[model samples]
Target: MRHLIRAEWTKMRTVPGWPIALLLAVLATIGLGVFTAAGNHSSCGGATTVCPPPTTGPDGAAVDDHFYFVHRSLDGDGSITVRLTSMSGQRRLPDAVPGVRRVDTGLVPWAKAGVMIKDGTRPGASYAAVMATGTHGVRLQYDFTHDVAGSASRIGPGSPRWLRLVRTGRRITGYESPDGHRWISVGSTSLHGLPARVQIGLFAASPGALHVARADLGGSIETIRYSSTTARFDHVALEGAAAGGWRRTDVGATIDPDGSVHHPGAARASAGRYTVTGVGDIAPRVDGMAVEKTLSGLLVALLIMIVVAAGFVAAEYRTGLIRTTLATDPRPGRVLAAKAVVIAGATFAAGLAATAATLPIGTHVLRDNGNTVLPVSLLTDLRVVVGTGMLLALIAVLVLALAALLRRSSGAIAAGVALVLVPRILATTSVFPDDVARWLLRLTPAAGFAIQQSIPTYPQVTAHLVPQSGYYPLSPWAGLAVTAGWAVLALVLAVVALRRRDA
Candidate 1:
């Protein structure tokens, strides 16, 4: 077994074309990634100043953390309760009425207004709250990504919703009530390292309304319109360790050149009643330049990989080298396994080297060009880099296995390309409708590309979660498993055919 593997490795290295093809694959991946990064520039008023980087949460994942707050510091264990009497919002219209910018009274489905206990007024700090949403009813949300549904009822002047948050050390619990009297626990979460002194407040936040516009060509484009939410809170009560009077802060607001907040949210108080209006969200960021976008050249590298893998096995058959090689080994399955190991290892190493270099360099170029790349956790970043390498190796193995079965390089290469590349192109290019595109990615070997997705879709945030937008229907490992399943099946069939055929 050892000698057979050694002989296979020798043959692969001695072939100048194979070694050259692998090198070209690596160069293509890195070159294309860096080029894509260089091409992308900030469109935020031609300056990077207005295009601030996405806020990162406590977990270091990109998050949206903008809202209006009327808060007082709590030095110890405490609770805050408020009755939300009314919630209203307005959305900007795409077309303006003559000389006037038209606006409509409406709220995006996730607009929230409620009571919150937060570590600080700073964006991305750990926090928890019970809120009344536009259409999602009452919800308990915390730590930027966690959300638990409560009541399915809406709030209005006649029918108000009561929200409460209690903080005891690091644990925070939320409760909702139809009336201020009877309360029901919504949910609870630990802020782990919460500070002894924290901000307890009433907040209002609204995410942008998403509208999908059909393009004249064929595909659809998603556009987010500006929207704001206002909530009237009365019967506000606080318990335990209050430090001072209420403070107003437009948390996460953008500062203008004169140091004033631009498009700032507002909070007003009168007779112990508070009206808060906010213009952003508190959820994971789903829209931006994903870090993996720099690896746009990966598809081109896949082509090179398929060519090399096909020739690895098909060349042996073409030159009648397999007869001499197999006669020495005798057992065909062992020979096939040795070839698979050699090809997969070589491709994996080359891919790892290319992707590891490409990701960081491309990310730097994107930031240098004033583009805001969405921040991902270190684990997620490592997964993308390592997963891309694994994807390449799996595809190479699949192609090599097919080449063994077909004994013709062109046939195997064509089949491999159709299975892997074509599906991805159709899915991402919007050549097919969204449903068909998603299915193409799910059922085909192209599913492996999901491993490159850096942005995770959040149900709490409304955005375009589609293939064209770089969000895959399947999770990373699951997608890779689909591709692996195909590769393993092909390898098994090839081994069986070799045993029965004349070879």
Candidate 2:
């Protein structure tokens, strides 16, 4: 096995064009990535003062983190209960143009004000809350993105609702009540590693944009401005050892008499009652969209890889080198396996270098161009970089298998590129309907592109989650697996051909 692999490696390196192709792969990947990132600029001018600084979600996507919070740090297990007397907000509707249709004016359904327990005040920190929403009634939400609806109940001056959040160690339970006495459990979640000292608070927030579908236009549209929500809390009570000596601090936006964008109204407390008004989202915005844009160069890199890999094996058959090589090895399958290993290794090395170089340089370009880049954990970034390399290596192997079966560089390269790249191009363009594009990506080898997807489609967020919009129908790893399956099937057929037919 070792000798076979060494012989294959020697053959690959001796071909000068093979090395040049790998180098081109590296350059193409990094060059395209940097260009894309540099060209894309943030709408906010890269200033937190003008717009909320870009924040990350638990899943590592970038988001807008602007809201109003009144909180106190607690030292241990505790509970906070408050009665929400009213929830109301002014809805800003877009003006009607002479030709353009007028958008409706109404509160976003998820706009909320509630009692919350947080790991800390940082934008992406884990936390949970029980809130009264603008139109969705009550909800128990946790992390920076998960939400669960509770019983529907109207909240106003006459119809008051009670919310209680109990923290016992790492577990937090939410309960709702029509009157202050009879409690019904909304939901329970564990905030892993919730510190002894955590923030317990009252908060209010709404998204910067509301996604609405326009049937006449045949797609979705976003609201031009945000709507603010206000809620009055009374009978505020705390329990357990850490609940005493409370203090208040605003979490995201501040109160300004001048009525600036950064001002989310104010929180006022008097005689055990509190009134808080705020705008902006408490949840993280999906960062995967940015990642897709930054890494758009991967398509070009993969095309270069496909051509190089197909030519590598087809050249052997073209020059009748395969017969001589197999004459020495006799076992044809071993020769094919050795060729796969050699191509996969070279592809992986080149891809890893390209991706590693692309991310930081590309991210820097994005920031310099006034775009916000979402931050992910070091582990997640590592996975993305390494995963990209693995994806390229597998693609090379898949192409090699196709070449082995077809024995013609043109035939194999044409088929492989069509199978992988064509669908992606069509899906991203307006040439096809969004549904057809999504299905092509989902069912074809192009699904492998999901491996690069970093943003998630949140149920709570309103956006088109199709391939054209940078959202993959499949999860990252699942999409890779589908490509792998195709590669394995092709390799099996290639091995059978090698064993039964004359090389």
Please provide, for model 2 over 263-349, each residue's C-alpha lDDT reduced to its tens digit, 9 standing for 90 to 100. Answer: 445778888888888877776665433654667677788888898899888998999988888898998888889999999999989
- lDDT (C-alpha, whole model) for all candidates: 0.89, 0.79
Question: Candidate 2 at residue 94, lDDT?
Answer: 60
List model 1 lDDT by residue over 5-103, tens digit each: 898899899999899989999999999999988888876625535666778988888888999999999988989988999999998777656667768
- Give the CA lDDT, 0 to 100, for residue 67 in model 1: 93
Please report, as a residue range, the 10-residue window in candidate 1 with the lowest summed lDDT: 43-52
Model 1 regions lying over 4 Å from their true place: 43-53, 96-100, 257-260, 270-272
Best by TM-score: 1
Candidate 1 Cα lDDT to native: 0.89
Candidate 2 collision pairs = 61-287, 62-287, 63-285, 288-455
Q: In every candidate, how many clashes are there? A: 0, 4
Winning candidate number (lDDT): 1
